[model samples]
Target: MKKETRHRATIIDVAKRAGVSKSTVARVLGGSPNISEEAAERVHAAVSATGYEPNHLAVGMRSGRSGLLGLVIPDIANPFWADVARGAQDQAAKEGMSLLVFSSDWDSAKEAAHLRALRQARVDGAIINPVADNLDGLDRFGMPFVLIGSSAESFPDTSSVGSDIAQGVRLGMDVLLAHGHAQPAFILGPKSKLARARFLRAINQHCIERDIDPASLHTEDSDYTVEGGKEAMSRLLERASKGRHLAVFCANDLMALGAILAVRDAGLRCPEDVSILGFDGIPSGAFSWPALTTIEKDGRKIGSTTVTCLFDEMAGRPEHGRVYIPCRLIERGSLANLLAGNTDRLAAGR
Candidate 1:
């Protein structure tokens, strides 16, 4: 037998149930303060009774706003970006707006496509970590937007938000210094990238302040990944003087985890043989072999604040400017068995 179709409740049904004009029901549902409280109450009751739901498309047409926000990020799987997306989503909900999120996977073409799609959808605003330097597409669309991530710093005139990378590095280094690990090593990004430049500048300043030789610092270039970090760490360990409290700072938690693995792979104990410090306070790091000490960048704050900036742009209020949120250092077992006591896996695995 053919199933009978169910009719969806409409604004008219709500108006009829409330015993008010359709315009009055519309005004009440649209949150117009001009509507009488009595009328609004009746309309709300009628809406519940009739199971009335407004057509979002129709509402957008009437208000000249889609009531939607767009986000385009480098990697959805990365825990940092995930937190960012969550923050933006939460903020959007508070303002009665919907969020549309996309991951560009570090592809410029894909990034461009997502931006175009946002324009086509007529999103009220967007937050993007741009993959391409050229942003002619944004100019053409005229949709209000905010840039996010360390790369956002490159666009000085754009409204943007990101972690204070240089400050975070310095904070991590200071901890190393206080702990008497004067000549700390590093697993950094490739020099061709902006991230590497920021890291180098911070490292140089820290060295200069303490009268430490910049040339004496041992550093290796690696992509921001566990495997890359492992390889870089392995090379650093191989060439270094044999075993005397070697400390290495990783660009991110994933790389730090990799470094830990490399030490273990070489039959060396973490913290005892080498101390590790990381950036980007991913939640998973807390549960690592030894909890990873890190410079914690507030990704959620970056995301939510970016949304706030987008709103300002949407309203044509604040002029464009970059916002840098400060990062804090979290010390744990990886900094040499000080905080989190660890059951040495490298020894046990043997």
Candidate 2:
């Protein structure tokens, strides 16, 4: 049997059925409030009869807005980025906008390509976690954009949102000191990373305040991954001073998890033989054998705040400064209190 073919409906068919001009149909569908109730009712009924579907591209061309926004991040697979994207999506819905997401995988070329694609799509604006050292991507973009991530602090001239890195470092150091850890081990990212510098500076200041020599600080560089943390911690463990408490701080949670594994592999117990502190309190941290002690930076709040900044830029407001979300300490089982009288206080923090 030959199936019957159905012709798709267009605005012209809707106009003809409603006895109105095509422009009237267009205006009604575009949500212009100037149409008469009688005409609107007839157009809506005609739309129902014809099953006409508006082409969003054409409507965007006519309305000067696509009703869309764009988001570009370094990595989508990271739990932190996942949370950030979810926050952006939720806020977009609240603002009556749709979002398109892309990941650059930390490649400058890929980041540039995503920016070009966003331009071609004619998004109202964008929120980007920039990868390149310069503002070339933002320079080429014709619309408003807000920067995000650890590196955003380097570009103070542009509007950016991110977790408070220095503050987080201070909080971590305080926890380490509270637990009688003065000679600490730091698992840091690449030296070029701004976050690493911030961490070192805060640690240095903390040591100076305590009258400890900054030159005595021990650190191992890592790639901000699980394996990287394991390898770095292993090296630090082998070279660490003997007969003293070991306190290790990882640049992020993934690395810290690896550090825990390294300690276990070396026949050392967490919080008993080695205490670990991690940053970016991802969900997996809670499930770790020794629920990770971490500085919980709110990725969701960072994402939503970045959108708010982009909106300000889209609204013709000057967004030239950085907006930072504070970090909170999550004192979990991984860190042990050493002060004889401080057990109750530290337990309450958990």
Candidate 3:
């Protein structure tokens, strides 16, 4: 094969184009606040002209702060995590930083591997939603890391940001109760984070207080996907019997959409035959048929807050403890009176 030549530009090119010393280019890339405004503008113009993307690896080797953050999660496909990723991305970009992402798929071994990889990448910090509660391996790494949405049996000095799902679930339950739903079926995702479990327990407790027998409450588990929600709701309906007045609360909006599909396929009407409630008010939920009634969490706020905490650590501040992100409920048309006409008619002909 013939040799192929590729055009590559370096910091020297940027400095030459900007008519500045190489040190000045380096300082600009390092985000030195002391750089003069006019000088900064010239360096930015030169950088754009030369299309010189810095050698981040070499920079990381030279300085402990790589201006890079690593975010590890289970699934990017999940809207909840997608929102989390958005938050991290927004925060990173705002701080003139970049991010490296890894999905552990709920596997400890994979999580361990990513942790080691991030260390080698010399990231400035990491925000991880651990696959499970195995913090021993992470604790031993002794790096600047924060946890998001999960915790361990014995955490050793880590910062965390997680949704208050317990409060969220309680709020959903209270909303359903206010809307005259006495018996609502529950759909839970398979992930067993402390927050999720707490929400589950709170909702179950709420049922008890409402005189619902444990056996009478329909419940099922899924893999936290839209398809999983659909199948689980199908199973719930099969076991609970048809024509029974019911409401459904899903662990997430994706699941709620799935359940809504299942309910409609069964020729039952949402909010009419069964009111549907979901957690994590993803944008898609709003445009969903009849509009989904769900809880909304400020994902961008969480992301920005997590980055702020990470910066504190980078600045040599003490490691942080847990941080809680509040949740809110949004009532829409997905929830309706039990006696209302078949929502199938409203949902149909779409």
Alpha carbon lDDT at 41, candidate 1: 93
Q: Name the best candidate (by TM-score).
A: 1
Q: What lDDT score belongs to each candidate, Candidate 1 first?
A: 0.87, 0.87, 0.80
User: Which of candidates 1 and 3 is the stronger one according to lDDT?
Assistant: 1
- Pairs of colliding residues, candidate 2: none
Q: What TM-score, over all chains together, does every model reach?
A: 0.90, 0.87, 0.84
How many clashing residue pairs, candidate 2? 0
> What's the number of clashes in each of the models?
0, 0, 0
Each candidate: RMSD to true structure? 3.5, 4.1, 4.0
Predicted candidate 1 versus true structure: per-residue lDDT over 183-241, tens digit per residue: 88999987766778888889999899989998998999998888999999999999878
Tens-digit lDDT string for candidate 2 (1-350): 99999999998999999999999998898788999999999999999999998887877898788888999998887788888998888888889788999999988899889989999999999998877545544577778888888777777888999988888988998888877887788999888677788778888988888899989888999987899999999999999766456889898999999999999999877877678999998989999989999999899998888888888999989875988899999888998676653444544454
Error of 2 at 84 (Å): 1.4
- The Cα error of candidate 1 at residue 169, in Å, is 0.9
Off by over 4 Å in 2: 1-22, 36-53, 135-138, 340-350
Clashing pairs in 1: none
Stretches of candidate 3 off by over 4 Å are 1-6, 14-48, 152-157, 191-196, 208-215, 339-350
- Evaluate model 3: give its lDDT: 0.80
